[model samples]
Each structure stands twice: as structure tokens, then as C-alpha cells.
Target: MESQPHNDRLWIKLLVLLAYKTATHKHARRLSWSSQTGGVIPISPKLCIKATPFTQLAEANAMRFVAQHTSIPVPMVHCAFEEKGQTYILMERIEGDTLAQVWGQRSDESKARILRQLKGIVEQLRRISAPPSIGVANVDGGPIFDHRLPRKSSWGPFATIQDFHRELRSGIDAGDIEDDASSPGVKDMASFHEQAWQAPVFTHGDLSALNILVRGDEVVGIIDWETAGWYPPYWEYTSAKHTNPRNLWWQEEVDKFIAPMHEALEMEAIRRRFFGDF
Candidate 1:
């Protein structure tokens, strides 16, 4: 294993110690500040907690599903509940730097190793049996008809790929595709809407490097299951690619790590162009 720098390790150890102390104190305010990924507070060396404005029951369930059914490295959900308009999740804290933080510092061989692990993880996820519906799965393996969107309101637990596609084109149906229907992207969406998709499968929904934790050449954990659900097989590739479209390096990461779904990406690109305003 390629170890993290000595100073980084020391800093992490210190944080863990402090967090452990706080958690051990029975009445200590359960608060540790993190501005970037809001409401995540390290509670202890072994556990962390997250408080979010949105409901995290789904996220907790998703993490549990992955942890139980697959060999994928993910945090163990200790407990999750909703309170005062916020959901709180307490989980195990897997220690590592995010792949995003260290990818550029790695050797090609290390990168390849990481990708192989991720490929195995994806294969395992696909092996999970899914129902006919296309949507997020509940804890008991039922579809959640209203899946939350990354940017705005919930969208689907669509019955089919066509239903999902129609939802994408709904902006035009609502007369909001764009200010100019003549815009090339708008016109492209109209054409792309007719494309078909393969049967639904389990998807991470958001699989950017930031969500993948790395320790040395190994993938220690895959985090952020908030958007995980059942979707068309190509959903993973298209969604990961969309995370940082203009960043050439991230594009390379998507290409190297995620199986390409050119047609799917093309359709997804069109959908975003059309409904992005919403």
C-alpha cells in the first residue's frame, strides 16, 4: 500500500482523537464543522454523523443495501432518523483521502489498480436482483416512485426507460425547454428523446472521484449513496461523465474507470440541455 504522507496521517489521527473524545463525552454537543460537504460531523474515531435538510432515510437504506449484499467498501450505517426537518445518519468512518484529492499524484499502475477495483464493485452492484420498475430502491428492496434529483425536486421511480425519457423532455411539454427552440441543443433534445434504453439496474447515480475514497492503491470506500437507485444500465456512465464535463482530467477519469455508454451519454446530454433550467 502506498501510504499517505506522514504529516497528513498525523493530522488525521489528531482529528480522530478529538472526535473520539467528543463522542465519548455523553453530553458533548455533537458538532464538528465541515463547510464543503455540509452537516457531516466526525463523532468519533470509528463513527461519523451527518445531518441534512433533505431526508436521508433513502441514503441510509442504500448504504445498508450495498454493505450487506455486495463486497463494496462503504460506511456501515449505525443509525439513521429524521428530526426537526433534518435527517441524521450515524455511520462508520472509513479513513482515507478521496480519490479526487490524490488522483493526480498517483502512478498509472496505481490508477489502473483502482479502476479494476471499481469495475468489480460495479459488477457486484449489477448482480443484485431488481424489480421491473425503474427507480430508487427502498430498504426492503421495493422501488421508490419519487426519486430525488440532484439539483431540484424529485423526478421518478419511472416504470420504463421511455417514461424517464419523457420526463426529460417534459420541459418542452411545459413550454420551458429554452428561450429559443431553435437553439441547436434544444433541437438536439427533441431528436434524442426518441432513443431507447436497456433494462434497469442498480446505479450509484453519482460516481465522481470525490465520492470514492482511496488509501494507497486501494479503493477504501465509496461514499455518497444519496442518489443511488435502480436505473437504466447506462445511467452510471452518463451520470459520472456529467459530474465535471469541462474538466479534462475528470473526463479522463470517467473514461478510464466507467464503462462507456456513448448513446446513453448523448441522450443524457440532450436531456440536461433541455431541462437544466429546472
Candidate 2:
């Protein structure tokens, strides 16, 4: 027999399918779409559906986990399920502009207030304890996803930070570096990766301004939890700094909110230099 939760999910899925069919000819509006990952559609004023073939149910699971554990405002997940080779997340549609949209128009005071609220939210996220034996993993203690990583696929729920670092180095051991032959930069990166790090903490993984929703000076919501997971404390800071040219201004503001991890950022730069973002 199917589990109770599975049964409930099936019922929800059926209802969602019906609603989707009905809304298609009337209320549905595509919020965002991608050829690779599917899209988000609003079927009602207060509800939306995010359907994607590339995303796992883990994204919805991460949102629910944050809602349950912290005071951070995130979209309320109505249901998440898989059917016809795609994952669908039915969620509340929050009414607010992404921080990216209003950032340039805001005064310094307004920006500071928003950043303050975000700092508190980040603190709350870090305070959540990871399950025992959890290394680097998603909310469900499974492989974590990141588009920045090569192949844009799920990586390991590594057993240890050292193991995770090894993976980051593309399976190259620190000792594999020849002191006499390897470039100074390569040797530095290998040494940096060998250093011990503090225990993993809950991380939002991607802290882009595009993901932060704001209303006036308040941070009303933080959307896009697809990359959330238990990760090294520096992961948040470094990830925030890894933004593109369009987000350069946001990257400058990152250190003001999250604690700066300069060494980690430098190490990450070295890794990227050796192995360009593919």
C-alpha cells in the first residue's frame, strides 16, 4: 500500500492537474519560462505553479524546510509532486517586486533596511541544525543542486568536508601537486583546500538580488530555494560573490550582509581559473 503522504500527494496532483487544465484557457499567465527547465505560471491571483523537468522535488522540500524552521518569508508550498517526467510545485504567489527591480530606485536608507532584514534571515538560516552525519546535502540529505557547478546537475551528499573539497578540486588530491613542477597558484589552491573548515551550516546557496522580494523597505519574501542545502559556512559568502556582470552592484553589497570569506572566495577563483565554468 502507498504511504499516507504519498496518497495525499496523489490527490493533490489530481486536483492540480484539473486546476491547470481549467486555468490554461482563462487565468493562466506565464511568469517565467526556460527551454531547459520548464516555467512558472500563475493560475490565480494568489497561487502559482512551477513546473520543471530539470528541477527535483528537493526545491519544494527546501522551501518547506525553511518555512518550518526559520522566520524567513518564503512562498507557502501547497503541494509538490511528479508526473509525466516533470516536477510541479503548487505555491502561494507572493505580491512584491524582486529586489533587483527596485534596487536602483531605492535610497541608501531603504537599501540598508532591506539588507538588515536579510542579515537577520541569513542568521536564522545558519542557526538551523543539520541532521547527524549530514555533510554537504540538501534539506532531504540528498545530493545538492547548483547551476554554477559543471554540468548543472546534483552533486554528492558527501560524507565529510574533506571529501567535498576533493570533489571541488576535480578529484585531485592535495598531495598530487608537485612542489617543483606545479604552478604557484595550483599549489596555493591545493593547500587552501586541505585546511580544515568549520562544520556545515544551512545555506540558501544562491543569494541573488533577483531572488529577494521586497515591498517598500521590508523583505517580504525570499524565493527560489532550488539551491538551498547544508554547506560550509563560507559557501553562502562565496556564492554571493560569484554573480555575473549584471549583478555586480549586488555582489558589492553581499559582504555588507553576509560575513566576508575572502580566503574562500580567492580559493574559489583559483578553482574556476583552473576549471572554467562549463
Candidate 3:
């Protein structure tokens, strides 16, 4: 007879295989798929699953944190678990077209109304302050996730804004600027970054129109909390500005809701130029 540990391993393998089949089943509707092995699929009318090799527990935690703290509309997470190396998130299936799908056709009045609602939501997010100990972190005080970062994965719960800025500069300290003369801009940018020590606020690190779900002119849901975390005050504005070509129009509208941080934007541009926008 097989040992109990071996049987448990076999059971896990079978469960993962079954989940993979369910994700690829004919009836399942694929929401998004990576070029590699992960994607989101709706197995039933009301139940959706997001499966990815990367750990998604942080995303789930962020969503739950937002739901509890604010009145913002977000999908209800049923459960999150890891199986064989893939993380599966079972959540409510929010039904609506992405804001991107309807934005182009919307009237100026309709767009203004939607932006008003979004501004209110952003204000609510900003109102939530991070505990002093947590500093810059995910909802649960763990390392934050942002694919745009060089690491492209979890990085830090930095004790100070300066520490977080150093990481953003790819470890080039303002003091190190004297030693490394290749990038003179780093010193100025790092100094500017150091001057602003605003307490970290809850940030939806990615505010793309594609992630907002809408019904008519109403925003029914804000999906995709993978990049949500407690970050410096300027983070939301900077991240919103770093939009894709398709989202250029949305980028123009970002400052309508989020207050413009001109200096931080300049610092971000310098950081991107020197370190690359990865």
C-alpha cells in the first residue's frame, strides 16, 4: 500500500489536474489568459476562478481589505487556496462591460458622471491610512505587488518612504549619486523624493479603464486588485499616468479625478529614463 504522505501528494496532483481541466472545459468562459499557464475562467454563471502560478493570496487579501473598509464595489471573494503550485481564487462573477468598452461611445455628460463617481471612490481610498508599523505594504502588511516594478513580484513593506524610493531608484541612494556619476539625475530625483514624507495611503496601484466594470454610466465594480497596496500619496497619480497606448485617452482624464502631482511625475520620468520602465 502507498504511504499516507504519497497518497496525499497523489490526491493533490489529481485535484490540480481536475482544476486545469475545468479551466479549459468547453463551457468555461475565459476572461483573460497569459501566454503561459494561467488565466481567469468562469465555471458557472455566478462563480469565477482566477488561476495563476504566482501566489494570489495577496490580491485576495487586498480585495477583502477594500471591501471591509470602503463602500467601493468589488467582487466578493469566496475563497483562495494554493494547489500544486498554482493559486486559485474563487470569487463572485461581476457582470458588466469594462469601462473601456463604453467610454468611447459615452457622451461628455455621461463620462463626467462616471468620473465623478470614480473621484469619490479615489477619495475614499485615500482616506484610509496605513498603520505606522505597516508603512508601505499590501493590505495585510506584507510585501506589495506591482508588475511594473523591476522585481515584477513582491518587494517590500518598507519602514519609510525614503527606503521605498531607494528601491524605486533600483538601489541607487541619493548619497550614492556622488560615487556613481553616470546618472546625475538620480541625486536630484532622490532628493526631491526625500522631501515629501506624506504618510502612505491605500492605493489602487492600477487604475486602468479596462479594470473598471460598468453598467450604463454607473461603475458596477472595480476589478483587478493585484497591484493594490499602501503606497506613497503620489503613487496613485503616477501609476495612473503610466498607461498603455490604448489607454492614452484615460491617461488624459486621470488628473480629472486624481490631483496632479507635477513634481512626482517629473521624478517618475527621470526614474524611468535611467532605470527603464520595467
- Winning candidate number (TM-score): 2
Instruction: Give the C-alpha miss distance for residue 198 in model 3, angstroms.
Output: 1.8
Candidate achieving higher lDDT, 1 or 2: 2
Mark the regions of model 1 whose C-alpha exceeds 4 Å error after superposition. Answer: 1-34, 134-151, 171-196
Candidate 3 lDDT over 86-143, as tens digits, reads: 6666678898988878889999999999999999999999998677666787777778
Q: Single out the weakest 10-residue window by summed lDDT for candidate 2.
A: 1-10
Checking candidate 3 for backbone clashes, the offending pairs are: none
Candidate 2 residue lDDT tens string, 72-187: 99999888877786777888889899887899999999989999998999999999987888888888888888877865477897887788778877888999975454454777
**Reference-based TM-score, model 2:** 0.90
**1 against 2, candidate with superior TM-score:** 2
Evaluate residue 157 in candidate 3 and report its C-alpha lDDT on the 0 to 100 scale.
74
- Candidate 1 per-residue C-alpha lDDT over 146-230 given as tens digits, one digit per residue, 9 for 90 to 100: 2334344555555666666666666344234543645556655555554565556888877878889998998999998877777
Give the Cα error of residue 249 in candidate 1, in Å: 0.7
Each model's lDDT: 0.67, 0.79, 0.77
